[model samples]
Target chain A: MRFDLIDHAMAVTGAIIRVLVYSILTLPAILVVMSSFTNGETMSFPPTGFSLRWYRAAFENDLFMTALWTSTYLAVLVAIIALAIGFSAAFAINRFSFRGKAFLQGLAFSPLIVPAVVLGIGLLQLFAWLDLTQTIYPLLLGHLVLAIPYVVRTILASLTLHDQQLEQAAMNLRATPLRVIRRITLPLILPGLLSAAIFAFVTSFGNVTVSAFLTYGGRVTLPVQIFAYLDTSSDPLVAAVSSLMIVVTMVVILAIERLIGTERLA
Target chain B: MLAPMIILLTGFLVVPVLGLLRSSFLSGNHLLEGSGFSLEQYFHFFSDSYYTSVLVETFFDGLVVSLICVVIGFPTGYSLARLPPLARRWRMIIVIMPLTLSLVVVVFGWLIILGRNGLLNSLFVSLGIFASPKILLFSRPAVLIVLVQQFLPFMILSVMSVVTQIDPVLEQAAANLRANRFATFRKVIIPLAVPGILVGFNLVFVLSVSAFITPRLIGGSRVAMLGSLIYERIMAELNWPSGAAMAFVLFVSGLGFTAALNALAASRFIVRGRRHAL
Candidate 1:
């Protein structure tokens, strides 16, 4: 009877703690969502009242809109470029037995672990030294490096899970290597590729540290813009923009969850 | 096929990082001529109390966060890993959502909650716990809380991966031996789960040390970290050389710590394997 009571008490305590921690994890986002509808300028808890004024203000502001367009285009471009290369690398790694293969894998994945600050500044100095235009190309290149690792990781997992006998049979049928890739391999991993593209797109879109050093000449990414905005303004406008981002993130994560199992993401 | 990948990595990734290395060794502040090779910039970081302290703070912050991550995340991950298949999938989605979202976007949530007239402060006032709303923003502890929230998923996933691989029979056997839940967890579960715990520790440590946004937004000027310090040097002072040096310091140290932990994990695995053989 005593052991049962203690066991029940401990279980209840654990449940309470877990619930508390999960609340801490999820509540701030809920607070932001609720606060964005504030009718007043002051950002107060429980909000000052309900209104869409800040959402209106966010769209009205040129900085936010311009940055929004900039981020969208860059992210789309980054997704396309990173996916193309990462797909090729994943294909090579999965199919081939070659020297320096481990080296290549390390090179591809290094950017994922390396601090973005170092990579960002390095790319900046490289571009400045080369005297190339710093606005678009360098930005693409910097984000490309950061996005490639996730692309490779996801595509590789897909490739490994897939039965290679299909590809082998295609090859035995004397299908051209390129045609085999086009016909057999590509279709099999297309969903994974899409997920990888989504991963790359989000990574590039959300990037700020690299964008910080790289952005100038009226082409700041949305994150960089939001960061700068917070320096001068603390109104409901920031909340409004943040809420929109939350909605978009929610949508994307759901879409991704449907497209590929959430396990691929982790 | 390999040509494009190689070109992308070598041209855009490898060469540029090499450029950063060269710049870090340069004598001058700005990325200009008279860039004689010098270690003065490295010395500058070590010489100043301000710079060294930030370095200390960065590592200490990482240590505390990693330890907290392991302590908090282990049980959560164990629970998730032990769940039924359907519940596991649903729980994973919630765990992954925060990781998928922008750090900047998520930090915005923290910004609102930790603001002067924010949720916790209001709760305190409403409950009559305090006479007034407390200023919780722009402090290290404030940032630390958010950091744990942000990086907690990585730790959880790390633990889950290993815990899932661990055979439940081992626990059953321990129970059959009349060991209680606590004893089974301490004797069997923890020993088996050390690899995962170490992986989670290494990951959380690397990430927290390298993180820029949480400290910037949540802690702000009040908490000086290596990331923010490097940002200020590069952006405000336009000191690429100094910034590059600091950045390298962070990178190399993070890598070193990772290597050390890997070695530790490997040695333990070997020792355990030998013991099992006996």
Candidate 2:
């Protein structure tokens, strides 16, 4: 009887703690959505009234839209470049046994440890000194550097899970290395590649620390623009922009959940 | 295969970082001049009491926030680990949603949630707890709250991954030995979960100390962590050397903390392994 009572108490404790913490973590995004619809001049919680004024404000604002476009294209370009390079590196490390393989692996993953602030400043100076800051190449390259490690890691994970004999069997049948890769290796890791694309896209799109210094001329990424905007205004339009991002993230996360189990993501 | 990655990472990431290091030690205010070396920048940085205080405060803030994450996240992660796959999937979404949001957007969401006239104040007003919206933004508590919201995902995910790897049969054995739920949790679960807790703790701590955006956006002018201070040096003062020094200090401190933590976690792991072997 006492044991059952103790179990009941623990259960009750777990239920209450779980509910409280999850709400605190999740409800703030809901509040952002609600407040973005406010009719008032300034933001208020529970919102004063419902209107899409801020949505209109966000749409009408040129800075937000341009930055959004810049960020989108930058992310797309980064996904392509990082995917191409990262895939080859991952394939090499996974399939081949060679000297310096561990060193190569460590080098590929080293950026995960370096502070983004450091990377931002380093790239900023590198570009400015080389007179490359005037173009978007710095931004492209910086995001590429940041995004590739993730791509390599994800593709390697898929490679690790795949059985080796299928590729060997294809090779034994007198298939060329390129043919084996095109027919067997590429088809097997498509899901991993897709996830890597998503990973690269999101990292590049959302990056600020690196882009903060590398944003050349009038071209700013959305995150950098939003951070600057928040410094000057406390208006609900920022909330509207944020809400849209929240919605997009929700959708991407859901799509990923469907394609690959959430277990593979973290 | 390795040629592309090697060339890209070396030419960009590695070379630039070397440039940054060289820039920090330059005699003049030149960016990465290969001509000369000096320590005046480091001297100027550590000589000032204000800069020293910022470094200290950044460490303190990281320690406190990291502790809170472990406390809150361990329990929460364990709960998620206990859930069935279907239930866990939905819960994982709720957890990862905040993580997936852009840093700026995440900070913006919290800007209102903890704003003066925002959610907390609104709740208080409706419940007659406060007469009107109170000032909560740009304060220490506000900064702490936002930092937690931003990085708690790291903690929860780390702990979850480790916790899930532990065998459920061990807990079953504990229960069968007449240990109650609380006793089993204390003896079997906590020991096994230590690795996750340490992993989560290191990630949250390392990321917390190096994070610049959360401090800049939410903490604002009132709070001066190393990240924001480094930003001021580079952006506002245009003093590259000083900023580089501060960034290194931040990076080194993170390295030291993690190294110490690894030693602690590894020692425990070795002892545990030996016991199992015996």
Candidate 3:
């Protein structure tokens, strides 16, 4: 059989088309980041110069610092609380066959689909009624609601996929339920829980819609802070902050990818 | 175990939804007052042609965006799903990049690309496509592009999950029967993938309908999607009744699409069963 030149040419053409498609899709996001560093007062297409002035200004800005810390603290707090509560909820449902199980599962996952603005309004109303609107607690609670769904879903998936027979074997060996869970189930699903925590952390950290309504003068998240800055004052400083956040997020993603396989996490 | 979750959901999701429905019935004047509970808000929103037009436009946008996402996302997801199990990990990561990013960040990125002096305009100019820069930002098309990109990950993930569940042997059998490439795909793969495609459609529909930031940021004053309108009424107009009404409409339409998708899946199941019986 003769080697087919036409088929090889077609294969090369197909690969080229795929590359073009990917570049077309990804170019806009890269352009946005590049444009944010423009050296002009008004946003320009091509940069006039290369400078790190924006980073310097943003680093020196106290408002940005406060918002960054607030967001970090809120995300950490949300991750801890959500992991604690959501893990328990996931464990219960996976271990037992009980009434209203489907309903409970539905409820746990409902927040994932619920619109952020609607949830923001609901939380805003609830907090106002309880006189908790201005406090950081409401912000924390709102983030918790958002983050819990991810934790619950990942942990539930993990629990479902883990070997149930391992627990049975442990019980046969005279291990108590708690010990079996701790020694067997926990170890198996710990990677999942850890990965979920990271996902929840990034989510709460970067959230805006819910945080926008809930933010007071002193209780804004980083996204809200950047939004306010963008609304009132257009500066490269916003880009510096955003680029920093992107770096932080990318680092975390890379770390998680290395720690546990993305396949297992997915 | 389930009690806390159920209680929280009932108090939060169910009650708020009911409250939204109830608020949609009260008059604009007596919205906050406890006494007035009429169908005036609905009458206002439905009767006014301007508001009705907005609703229709938003609905059309949702449908179009959903269709586009499904068309683009399914092929990409199929490509990922068909990869060897060992190669699936990196493909999954690539698929989830958009999902992991925040909406605000995504919109921010779009702002740069769609801006008047943005990269697209620059590239177009360099390519000799236009004499001057054309504004692409804040247009309807801009909003649609960003939205499709934002939700593409969800559709991919959903369809990818179901695609992975389909048996490879079915395709092999179809090929063994002398079915060509397109025929094999149509007969063997599409039937198994109907549910996942419907799932992707429902998700995209519901989300595209409710997206706020992308429309507001990219659509600007030229376009008004339902979510942006709801935000305007609530925050700017201080019309809580109207906001609640619009929210109720969005929620209903979302559920409607979901229900329709479910019905389509169910009928498909019935048809498949009859075929099997025959």
Candidate 4:
């Protein structure tokens, strides 16, 4: 009886600790959302009153608007390009048996292991050396490097979950190789491809460390703009902008949950 | 099919990193002006006390943050694994939502929470925990807190992945063999969870060690870390050689730590496999 009582007490303690830790993990986003509606000119906790003036301000600020557009455009391009390359690479890795297969796989996933700061500085120097610092190519290439790893990892997981027998069966049924891929393989991995695109988009959009180094000619991504803004000033506009991003990210996450299920995501 | 990816990686990643390495060995501040290969920048890094301390502090910060993540993440992961599938799915979303948000947004949230007259200060003052609002922002502790928040998800996910794979039958078997809850946890659970814990440790360590924005914003000029230092040198000071050297150091240490952990994990799995065979 005493042992059962002790076990019950321990379990309760563990549950309480879990709740506290999880709360801490989610506290920042909750606070940012709460403060975004502040009526005051400056950001504060338990914001003086509820209003959406900052959101209006964030939208009206031309610098911020341009950054928002830039970020979205860049992220879209990165997602499409990363998906095309990642899908092909993942397919080849999953379906082929060839020499240096392990090396190719490792090289594809290598960016994840390299610190973003290192990659950022390295690319900054590389572009300077190539005299390509004046264009948008540096930012695009840098983000692509960061986004590819996640895309490959996601598509690889998706590819591994389903077997190749279906592709083989299509081939056996007198289907052309391209036809088999178009009819069988593409449809089977549609969810994975979608998930991979989402991953690439989010990775590119949320990037700051790499973007900070690569932003040039007065064109900055939204996150880097926000970072630079915070360095100079503190205002509720940032809170509003951050809250907007939180909503967009929540939508993306919900989409992933719907597509692949969050369990697989974990 | 793989040609495009291989070409992209070789052109961008490999060539750039090689350029970085080459620049680190260049003698002068300017990359092009340096005539011959030299170790001047590395010598400067090691010979200078200030720079050496920053390296030490960076590693110290990584170790502390990694340890805290393990301490907190293991329990959370265990609980997450124990939850019902439906409940677990919702909780997992909440856990992962912050990771999807930009690091800047997350750090901004911390700035508000830890700022003077911020939520934490206001709450503490109202409860008489402190007589007045305290300066919580722009401090080392604040940076550490935010870094942990930023990277904790990685640790939790890693641990949860492994703990979910542990067979419940073994735990039940331990219980049926007269093992107490503590005994089962200490014997079966800890032993099985070690690999996950190690992987999480390496991840959090590498991440927090190289973290830039969080430390730059929260710690400000008061707390200097290698990541921020690299930024200042490369961007603010235009000292590319010195910056590249520090970046290379960060890269090598991260790779070395990961390799050591991989070796350890491989050996552990081998022992576990042998035991299973027996």
**True contacts preserved, each candidate?**
0.54, 0.69, 0.24, 0.73
Error of 3 at B110 (Å): 1.2
Best by TM-score: 4
Q: State the lDDT of candidate 2 residue by residue for B80-103, as single tens digits.
A: 887899899988988887777788
CAPRI-style docking class of model 3 based on DockQ: acceptable
- Which regions of candidate 4 are displaced past 4 Å? A1-9, B261-278
Off by over 4 Å in 1: A1-14, A169-174, B268-273
Q: How many clashing residue pairs, candidate 3?
A: 0
Expressed as tens digits, the lDDT of each residue in A158-218 for candidate 1 is 9999888998999999999899889998899888998899988888888887888887556
Query: lDDT by residue for model 1 over B26-48, one digit each (tens)?
Result: 87777545557999889988899
Q: Write the per-residue lDDT of candidate 4 for residues A157-264, one digit (tens) a residue.
A: 988988789988888899999999899888998998998899889988889989999986677999999999999888999998888889889999999998988877
C-alpha DockQ of every model: 0.55, 0.65, 0.38, 0.70
For model 4 the local lDDT of residue B9 reads 91
Question: Order of candidates by DockQ, top first?
Answer: 4, 2, 1, 3
Native-to-model Cα distance after best TM-score fit, residue B95 in candidate 4, in Å: 1.5
Tens-digit lDDT string for candidate 4 (B1-278): 99989988988899999989989998878655565799999999999999989988998899889888988888888888878998888789988887888999999999988988689998999999999999898888888989988998888988998999999998888788877787777778877888888878888898898998999999999999899999988889988889999999888977787788778877986587568537
Best model number under DockQ: 4
lDDT of 2 at B231: 78
Minimum summed lDDT over a 10-residue window in model 3 chain A is located at A1-10
Tell me the spans in candidate 3 whose CA falls farther than 4 Å from its real position: A1-21, A36-40, A231-234, A264-266, B29-34, B268-278
> CAPRI verdict on model 1?
medium
Structure candidate 3, residue pairs in collision:
none
lDDT per residue as tens, model 2, A1-266: 24578888888887887787788788778878888899998977768888998999999999999998998899999989899999999999998999999999999988877888888988888888888887898999999999988899999999999877999999999999999999998898888888888888888888887888887778899989988898777798888888887777787788778767787766
